[model samples]
Target: MKGIVQLNIVQFSLIYLLLLIILYIMKRSKINQTKLLIVASLRMTVQLVLAGLILTYIFKNPHPIFVIIYLIAMIAFSIRRVLSKNKGINRNFKIALSFSLAISGLFVLSYFVMAVVQVNIFNPQYTIPLAGMIIGNAMTGVTLGMKTFMESIKTQRNKIEALLNLGVTPKKILLPYVNNALETALLPTMNNMLGMGIISLPGMMTGQILSGTLPTTAIMYQIAIMIAICTSVCLTVFSSLHFGYMTLYNKRNQIML
Candidate 1:
């Protein structure tokens, strides 16, 4: 098979013209996202370009320290983004969110890299991109779970208080909400999995195929990564909600939120 064809500047720039169609549609529909669309497109372009540069350098000068630093940065940024979306959470809740995301993400990523891929953990070419995918998905899952859990608690405050008065344990009362939140968090990943071959081609598989990997090999990696993502997401969301709900009640067993 031939090597992947590289797109030159002109060819790549032409893709931006497609964004004009989106902008036009948004404007005609009176959607207030024109500025957001433009800013997001520009930011994505800049970030990916910078990432390419950094990745090129890292790939050339691979070191354990560089890999460690990159992983830390990814986890830290993921935690920050999750926390930023969840305003007014307590310190303990913040810790839970950060801990779950970092721990679960790293654990799954480490296993996927060292166990499944059988590569040195410090191998930047594989570790960095895989970590980004795992950590990014975990962050998204935890965010959605947190949002759903918080909203459920707030909306069902009266029911919770009633349950508490009826001598129900906090764990028993809050378990359902946690379960619901987890289900909500897992749905997108599950749905994506359901539609894998029929509805859409996943990005990782497409990239590997484009880079001249065998279709069978790419399919295997895609399947493994998808499972890893789902597991990471499940662990992170469950941990966050499991530990997070405890923060909602105190020693008196009264509903705090």
Candidate 2:
């Protein structure tokens, strides 16, 4: 049977109303947060409605090209999010991060859905949602990592130049900044893993149980997703750094960014 919680729209609406009440009472932040909240809610509802219709049609078609096209769209959306998050970054940095996220996300996700699961047909049902998760997480990692790295290097341009004058390699001079950026990027993923079951109910696992999957099955998928997140995060961070550093060092191997 479909779980009873799925039909409890009234109860959910009550919680939403209570949240709105709390926001109204708080009265902090100079911006019109209440209006923002209302607009966000409306947009969310419309987006979900459209997504449901599109996904239904996609599943019926069952074509590999279209599934991949949807994945590309998701990745593009994610890149835009990254660009917005790190405002004022160089244009080349944006392009580098985009390529890094695309490559790293696709590599990890393909391994998960193809080699690990070995599912036939590979319909949109399994591919799209999981790919979205991987892409979203990887985008965060790449963007944060690249943005932080750029800021750190730019701020420490003097140190980098001194190292260059001292005949140190570009990568060697940037080592500390790169390491810190990677750590910063991975911190949220680590936090999520640490607090997975206790502090927050993850969306995918909660949905699975709500749809009648056993508790154990939900936990398994959650575990797999966490692993995939880590994998994707690491790959994206390294790739962005790997290629991004190239633009900074010139033909004479001097630090230039």
Candidate 3:
């Protein structure tokens, strides 16, 4: 196979024309998001470039300590981002979320890296990217699940109270909400699996193909990654929802408002 075609600076710069067109259309529509769009685009460029540099270093070094530390930072950042969206959530709930994400995300990541991909656990080139994908998706799932679960509880307080008064257990009363949250959290991943190859080519597969990997090989890797993502999402959502609801009650079995 021939080497992959490399883009020149001019060619790469042409992509920004699309962003300019978006800006122009937004301006014509009087939407007034020019600054926000510009800032977001700038941040995306800067962050990805920085990540590329860091990842390159990590790949060369291949140190397990660095990999471990990076994973911890990713989890910490994800937990912070998830908790920031919900001001009403307490520190205890934050701890639960951190624990849930760390456990679930790591479990799936370990299985994928060690068993499926069969890469060295400390191999930054393989482990880092796969871990990033799994943890990122799992983080998103936990955020969605936690938000939906809390909202369901808030909106269904009367029903919950009535059920509790009728001698229904708290867990039993919250089962429906748990189910709803899990369904909502997993919907995006499920939809992606359903639409893969038909509706859209996922980023990883596209990257692999661009880097000269065989299409079939890229597809196989994408399938494995997607399955890992789904499993991690399910585990994270279930664990977070199960522990999160417990934070709503006290030792007396009374729900906190």
lDDT of 3: 0.88
Worst 10 residues of 2 by lDDT: 1-10
Q: Which candidate is the best by lDDT?
A: 1
User: How far off is residue 54 in model 1, in Å?
Assistant: 0.4
Rate residue 64 of model 3 by lDDT.
Answer: 92
lDDT (C-alpha, whole model) for all candidates: 0.93, 0.82, 0.88
Error of 3 at 206 (Å): 0.6
Better lDDT candidate (1, 3)? 1
RMSD (CA, Å), candidate 2 to true, equals 2.6
Q: Report the C-alpha lDDT of model 2 over 88-204, residue by residue, as the tens digit.
A: 655676678788888888888888888777674267888889998999888878778877888888898888888889999877887788788998999989989999999988999
How does candidate 2 fare on TM-score?
Answer: 0.88
| lDDT, candidate 1, at 148 | 92
- Which candidate gets the maximum TM-score versus the true structure? 1
The model with the greater lDDT, 2 or 3, is 3
lDDT (10s digit) by residue, model 1, range 143-230: 9999998899899988988889899999899999999999999999999999998898899999998999998999999999999999
